[model samples]
Target: MHKYYLTHLQELESEAIYIIREVVAQFDRPAILFSGGKDSIVVTHLAKKAFWPAKIPMPLIHIDTGHNFPETMEFRDKLVENLGVQLIVGSVQESIDKGRAVEESGINASRNELQIVTLLDSIESHKIDAAIGGARRDEEKARAKERFFSHRDEFGQWDPKNQRPELWNIFNGRKRMGEHFRVFPISNWTEMDIWNYILQENIAIPSLYFAHQRDAVYRDNTWLPASEFLQLREGETIENKLMRFRTLGDITITGGIESDADTLEKIVAEVSATRSTERGNRSDDKRSDTSMEDRKKQGYF
Candidate 1:
């Protein structure tokens, strides 16, 4: 008799693929939330592989905070064009213009929190019953409590204390009308697992992830990119530095670290040895310990 078992990476890949397929089979209308970040890129790649020979079964949805890095926007457009997939952008600016959400004020203010309204608006407008995201449990404490098939009420509010159980890889996506679900196919994969998968798959990511020289300012113990949207403080000074983003989001809050990891090999090695969480550099999360949890409860991704 011959005995065979899947490796760790293989098992993770298989699980993710299975989850992706299940989303398609279960939802009336489904979409992948593509942020043009490494994690989302990996999820999109897995989606492509899961339905090989046929184009990905769902459209890609992007909630534009309007503060995204230029490189990230460019990568998003190019990837969508190349893949020939439909892209739906829910703009925060539009939401603000329509008086649906108010922008945060002050020096450290970011559009991150306001994204919740726009995201929910997009989902309701698009009639998307399931929104697949790249969020990983290991990335943050709030995310750690997420279910593979998370239920959201008619108002798109999440009840963390009232989540369904997923024992033996079984997921219950059943929900009534006016309600929806948030699916995370890569929920089990960690930051290291993501980098390793990206390296193994030769995936293309945003240039922001690689070390490069850019004008940045030290703020909140992290180097924030100096851009037109950034409001510098009284004592803050801008200078050129070699830095790379561990996580990407609104440029106003996303911070980069001094790094020389220009290639995937170098990045993988650095990630393996790093002790800090990926979102540690994000100023938005620093606002409160339950920041993500609070936002998530109100339908933020």
Candidate 2:
């Protein structure tokens, strides 16, 4: 008899693949919430491997905030073309124009909270029963309470108190009509695990993750990329710095950290030694102590 063991990366890969397959088996119409971020990129990669020799079964859904990085858009288009999968975009600008979602105001305003309405609208419009996301438990306090298969109400809101139990690796995806589910395939993966797997698989990611010279400004104790959407405060000034993003989001809120880790291996090593959470740079999470939790409850991803 021979005994074999899987490495840490392989185990995580296997677990994610299993969850993805379950979405296919359990839901009628499932789609991936692709944001072109590293976590979503890894989830999309696992989807490719989950159904190899054939095209991915579900379409990729993107809730466009109209504040994206140019690099992220380019990478998203290229990846969609290469994968030969359908891409569905839900535009927040359209939502605002149609009076569906109202944009916030003030110096710290962002489209982050506005994404909730756009996402729920897209879900309802597409009749998507299972919306697969790349949210990890280790990212935030709200995400830590999520299950492998999280259920949502008819209004697309999550009830933390009313969640299903998953014992012995079993998941219950039962839901009523007019209700949907948010499935997280990589819920168990951590930031370090994601980088390790990306390095091991030699996955292609957006250029924003690498160290490069960019115009940025220090705001709220984080280096925010200088963009047209940004309105400078009285004493604010932009300066060129070698920086990289640990996480990617709207250009207005996603902050960058000073780093020289341009390669995948270097990123892995940097992540391993970092002390902050991957989402720590995101200004959206800094709104309040329960910011993410409130968003999740209101159907934000």
Could you say which candidate leads in lDDT? 2
Off by over 4 Å in 2: none
Looking at model 2, the pairs that clash are none
Ten residues in sequence with the least summed lDDT for candidate 2: 1-10
lDDT of each: 0.92, 0.93
Candidate 1, poorest ten consecutive residues by summed lDDT: 1-10
How do the residues 1-301 of candidate 1 rate in per-residue lDDT, one tens digit apiece?
2558887888999999999999999998999998888989999999999999898989999999998899999999999998888999999999999999998887667899888899999999999999999999988899999999999999999999989888987889999998999999999998999999999989999999999999999887799999999877787789999999999988888899999999999999998998788898988888789988999999987
RMSD of 2: 0.9
Q: What is the C-alpha lDDT profile of model 2 across 106-216, one tens digit per residue?
A: 988999999999999999999999999999999998899999999999999999998888877677888899899999989999988899889889999999999999999
Backbone clash tally (model 1): 0
Cα distance off (Å), candidate 2, residue 108 = 0.6
The local lDDT score (0 to 100) that residue 295 gets in candidate 1 is: 90
Residue ranges of candidate 1 with Cα displaced over 4 Å: 1-3
